[model samples]
Target: MDGNTNEQPPAGEETPAGVRRRPWPLRRGAAPTGVRRSLRMAGVTLAVVLVSLAGVVLGVFAGGRVDTDIGPFQATLTLTPDTSGGTTVDIPPLGALLLDSHDGPTHLTVRLGALDQMRTEALIDDPASIQRASVSAVEDVRTGVMRLGLRTVASAVLATLLLAALVFRNVRRTALSGVLALVVSLGSLGAAAGTLRPQAIEEPRYEGLLVNAPAIVGDARRIANDYTRYAEQLQRLVGNVSQLYTTVSGLPVFEPAPDTTRVLHVSDMHLNPTGWSLIRTVVEQFDIDVVIDTGDITDWGSEPEASFVGSIGVLKRPYVYIRGNHDSGRTAAAVARQPNAIVLNNSTTTVAGLTIAGIGDPRFTPDKNTSPAGSGLTKPVAEQVIGAGEQLAATVRNSPRPVNIALVHDPASAGPLSGTCPLVLAGHTHARQVSMLPQQPGLGPTQLMVEGSTGGAGLRGLEGEKPTPLSMSVLYFDKDKLLQAYDDITVGGTGQAQVNLERHVIKDPQAGEPVPVTPTPTR
Candidate 1:
């Protein structure tokens, strides 16, 4: 009876004929504790992997290629995990960013993270320079930057390992582990979003590179269509630029002492903002005490350009202004608003220890709104122009200072005043010329200097013709407050101060000679 009881039930004793309970392969009840724990840990590992994968997908979506536009320039931004595991942006050649004259070297420098950087000392004058310039500085990249990036990755890995160990330990620990994992994921996402695309950029200093390639092409086409002699115009532009760098090398780079007075003669700014920076450089370089602007501050002589008149503030020195035919009364009013600006319209004043007298343009344009006699006035106000010149000459002749200087907009207006002052500075010819007019009775030979359009013939010059040289002159004063030296400097738009380009004509005041000068080789 006992044997019968032990072997009585069949394999499917209480089940249907073909549907038997599948054996779990173990005769023991339930699974062993180790097996159960192993399964649970496997699940935890899988979940961690899934969450990490999701985070990666989210980061990829959040951080995609970004585009930026600054003025007429265009550039692309990209995200990259550097060798040290830190996020960084790789910016494609920004093309030309219209470098701020106050910032940076004349070269392109890639600033990555904090200490990772690379730079090319050469300016991006040609398009090809972009590629050559993108080299990374191995030392800068590997030093401080690597340490920072490694530290970040080490922290993330440490957090992940600790969370994983806790999560695999037991079900009760899952909640704590999950919370920590979520915190890590959130931090990762935030870091990805913040570092992938910088909210703003500190524009790099570059020169002569294409900004918006399409826009640049369109501008070129428009220029060609408007100017009949496009080739000739371009040739002239390049020629003048070459000549400028060539001849300026022959001039001395004087390092005048402090407490000395230097005069900067900037004429026909023509609303070209570039001239302001040029003026500032000359002021600091030469220890200039005064800046004399010979009008034509704007191209159109319109009220809208009045704000540009505030450029006088950039000089940070006493500025003397005389109205040009291209300048209007509104422009004069703007210049007068500056605390450091003195409007010598048919008036005489002392500045930087020198006597300066000047007159305003007489012609307001007969029709007024038609055109400038120079740019806005439709017709030249001839009678008034000539008459004003005569009066300004008569008034400044008796100035008390031995070194009397006259500032006039148009050289034509300055003709009658040649011998009236010790030195007469004028613009409008768009050419640089210095001459000693026939000596007056009591006056030593009076110097009549006509400076090139500091704006390179204003903006109009860029349209009809190849602009004349962008030029300016510096006047040095002796301890006796007498005129010491007058030097001329020319520049190209690129601001590539080349010591060697070609040959050019440099005039010498003392020798009264037009010397052919060759540029020195770059250091």
Candidate 2:
């Protein structure tokens, strides 16, 4: 009784002198049992998710690729994560064709590889072999895809199990991870199957050298209607390939003249991806020295549409640009920011050995909500364009250097520049026209060249029953900066794959005579 009385004080009371106080029985700062259990479960769930993600990434890296033969051609199939589900056929050193073939979290890529020479030759020479090879190619591709799916799933499951074992140190957890991986893989497969678009092969977007993919593949629907027709088409394709190879290999090395300047004239692109491809191909194939765009490079002149102008940099040639009715000041600024681009707005600049002058269109006509107040909202009137042209002519006349070429968006804007420069380029009507303006007493005549829509007038071309053709012109200049000859190039309208070129030669530039306009068809 004496010891208890000496040791004890009220629970909250402090002990005096050397007397010790017993500690409280309850443990402070400890979580409840239910909360601790919940935290443990959360940690396990997080670990499982992280392990599964790592497994999927590793599986894609290790087992996503499979090499197989598509008849005579070898190809590699690969699985890659892409929100935009599609199949891409990549032809090395050329380009790729993208098809909206399916919808899923993963993208399928079939990279065309080396061709078996013997087999290709056999298919080309024998009609029967074409049919057999076509059938075999389809079957082979099917089998290869199945094999790739199995391998990828197995790899992912194995990786998940190993990671789970290392992290959890429990067989039950590892087994659970493997099962999760399988479920995920099956779910992806099911999604792809449900959204498969077999007809997507008919509509493809081509990049780089494969921009001519539509022409090479022909109409898919017609080809699929008859096996014999399909074989015939395949035979022709092989024959064309062989012939092209032979012709190109036998041709002598080409060396363009040092004194000659080649300029590509394109206008009214209107934000067509195919138009950019065509421009790139022409720049490479024709050895173009410069690209001159009269304008309308975009539709809405919105910030989002400015990205298309980035293609100008990729052209790798001097790109002289001007704003069109549909292009706002923002669009012109975006173009000005691109590499190798020169924006002309009542200004003069020399590029690729030619002195040029250009002016922006006076009006901006964009869709509602595309531009700031008082801009890109009104249609361009004729008087406004004429005034812009008069101002540009004054600027050209006061330039420090002689302007060899003058550019404007509308033909009306080109009117005041008749005697200002030897050549005036304009595009607005979406039609091609070439004529010599009447010569002044003491000045040489000006050649007015209006280009058709390089982008087939963009989506608007398809609104009518007959789609407009995509067109451009190649101008050749001599050392004197005189236009000597030019080629008018035309690509078939929508649903057509033919190409036509017409060449015009200026017999005497100094004679103030009209250039002979002859339509020489070459396909």
Candidate 3:
């Protein structure tokens, strides 16, 4: 009432009559103008990046493959985003091999499809044809790679532009995003090309059944370092391939009768990955129903070595295994885990209409650190092996089903089982031998069959002057489940490209004397 018409109320004081106070425009839950602008820019940038990535994924999966023929082999090549830049050669059921062939942001994969049998046979018959095929293969691979690269680049650009237009919804922004994506794609490819490493072929990492790469390729470093030597090695490789085809093609055609069962007998694999390929090929080619392994599957029996047993599952046939002197309890457990694998330890199991009994060797001599003192390290005496064999014989006699085959790791262990089963299979001498034990009182005489090293004694074969031959046998059984005949298959060791197959037929199964009456060479 002091009569100051323009007088204003102090901050926090009540407003004057007839005057109104405006509320704060920036109320709760509202951000500042500068902050809002920054958030909008960030959101737009994030959207652009996400869309670009999606475009790349679409490009790779939709159109990143090319098919071509190399020599007599048909193959498909593909490019994919991967930080570990390398090349992978996939050979289907045989497994894959990875090579550090280059350095880049992408990976290259070559999947082999089929082999032209006629072309292969021609190559084998004509040495000049081999030279022509090798030259043609190189040219074909080069052209295929170029086509694949161009298609991948074009696919990426098109995909990026389409995605950018959908995301930005503006001509200017979409154009800018497309340019950015193109720049990135081209840069990545340029970087890969600039960092190529042809020498990486000297050291390839093998996977699956191709783990025998070293044995097959034969010292890649040596070949790469010397050009003249490389030429020789290449010729040898071609020769080996031709020899392999010849052997496989010459195999006797087996038309298995409905009631007849064929079993593949292998032993002393010694952890050779090539053995897997050999076994699988035989299984498919011969129509094998059951596979019997007489032990020594691994060399060290360590945890890492246990992984080799995975091949047992891949075989897709009933695998009967027993532990050898070099195999530990852990090794046995690994074999047991494989699908379709049967681990026998003083036990019996029926497979393919044949009742088989087996027992693990008592000795474990590979690694002293893992094996127990004395008994594990020392060589088992004749008495110890014979006693173990006696235990297996007792188990066979007590089985609910009549045992037709007795399996043991050592030949000595098979002695006590002479009359327990009709056929006794054993390994661990690394030599093939067949003999008929004297007739027993109650049971028929036993036919003892000992197999050699199927893996050619693994890597140890390289140490000797002459590599040991890789050996396996295919046993044919009659409809009555009686042993009839077997074909002994032997492939010459490293640097040797010879395959020898001997067919031995048993004249009389019930007779006390059984011998290889006629030994015929199939190849």
Q: What does the lDDT read for residue 113 in candidate 1?
A: 22
lDDT of 1: 0.54
Better of 2 and 3 by TM-score: 3
The global Cα lDDT (0 to 1) of model 2 is 0.75
On TM-score, the candidate that comes out on top is 3
Model 3, stretches more than 4 Å misplaced? 1-256, 367-380, 512-523
TM-score, structure 2 vs. true:
0.52
lDDT of each: 0.54, 0.75, 0.74
Q: Give the Å error, residue 277, model 2.
A: 1.1
- Sort all candidates by TM-score, best to worst: 3, 2, 1
| Error of model 2, residue 216, in angstroms | 31
TM-score of each: 0.48, 0.52, 0.52
Query: Runs in model 2 with CA error above 4 Å?
Result: 1-258, 368-380, 494-496, 511-522
Worst 10 residues of 3 by lDDT: 368-377
Candidate 3 whole-model C-alpha lDDT, 0 to 1 = 0.74
lDDT of 3 by residue, 315-396 (tens): 7999999998878798899899988999999999999889999999877756321211123323546577777899999999
